[model samples]
Target: MNDALGEPQSVLVLGGSSEIALATVNALPRRRLRRIVLAARPSAARDLAVTTLTAEGISGVTAVDFDARSTESHSVFINEIFDAGDIDIVLLAFGVLGDQEAAEADPALAVEIATTNYTGAVSIGLHVARRLRMQGHGSLVVYSSVAGDRARRSNFIYGSTKAGLDAFAQGLGDALHGTGAHVLVVRPGMVRTKMSAGMPEAPMTTDANVVADIVVKSLRRGKETVYAPGPLRFVMAGLKSMPRSVFRKLPR
Candidate 1:
């Protein structure tokens, strides 16, 4: 359950090892958080995440086995977590930015991206939503991307997946309206993380911690949607309004 101030005292992060997710955990009121569940596939990174959070003075930090790509098991996986205790927040943060060129060349690769980013998310997202609504309170923060605002030629495959995810998250938010269960869709531009370390830095690029701050603040303000750096909201709006003919030629 949340604290007296309505700050979440418990959290469930789908991608336990995600830098941004971990950053959000750190950004929250550490003293108020009593239970922190990090769900991700078994890995050394996941283990390190648990150890790191614990060392950071966050109590009740633990990791559970969770495979986002394994959609069939999501229902059982999610229910088991909720059965143990009520969750105050669920962060749907699992995703892969597949090699665009490789994915386009190999259909198998593209399918993998779609399956993980879209199908897997939909499967787990709905189950999480059900539990949130049933419990009658909690926040679902979906880490969507600015790339989803409009598909660019360079990484349309990844962008398209985010597009689908963004739409699903928005609709889910609407359905959960007035139920005390809400959703916050986060659309971040290029962020400095292991995921984007090698990629060219985009305009208004920020870091994982910055995005984390935005997530926490948005949740507090009851914002349905937000941009990480805030300015990207206007940037995305302009690009969204621009004709595709001219938009396509712009640098990705």
Candidate 2:
């Protein structure tokens, strides 16, 4: 393993099958990084993502099964990857957005959204963060959303979970300061992807490719927070400052 940046030339991605996650991996500088581990839920889509990565001439991209909800196995799973002592970068990109109407109608749906988006991430991410800290050098890239800035009536359940995740990432980033392990929190405005196909279009919608590109650029520059499309950072600032009485009346 080379130490061009004073760290291992390898990366481990926790939610490897995500479109944005895969895109970010593809965007990394292949000449500098030598190995990539793509961990995802045991699903056909995961296999497809692995195939796509291999086709990109990434040299050493592979997939492994990982379930975010199975908290009992997180330690063992993380150990297996870092055991080789070659991990230097990590990406946390697993998430789920259930039907908002259903989530509002059923308490169980709301619970699932919270468990999947926030609770599961907390369980696995903490473990990953600790491992990286122990190793004394790495970068953790987290995928968050601008929806987390505020809860809208249109999709508060999903938005609430994202909001929780965004907060968690920020706090984690702070805790890692001066530890040689850094967290990169990514906030994408609205991504048009398979998960969001049937949903109504939102303003400033960006593609997974755009988000990935920004992430790679941010990593190279050591930016702690990145807003995909760049302008959404200002837009979210405006959104957070608006009065709730006026915010609630505005259309999503």
Choose the strongest candidate by TM-score: 1
Please name the candidate that would achieve the greatest lDDT relative to the true structure: 1
Model 2's number of clashes is: 0
lDDT of 1 by residue, 133-216 (tens): 899999999999999999999999999999999999999999999999999999999999989988889889999999999999
Scanning candidate 2 in windows of ten residues, the lowest lDDT window is 1-10
- Per-residue lDDT of model 2, residues 175-222, tens digit only: 999998889999998898888988787889999999999998888777
Clash pairs for candidate 1? none
**Regions more than 4 Å wrong, model 1:** none
Which segments of model 2 are wrong by more than 4 Å? 1-8
Question: What's the CA error at residue 116 for candidate 2, in Å?
Answer: 1.4
Q: Enumerate clash totals for all models, in the order shown.
A: 0, 0
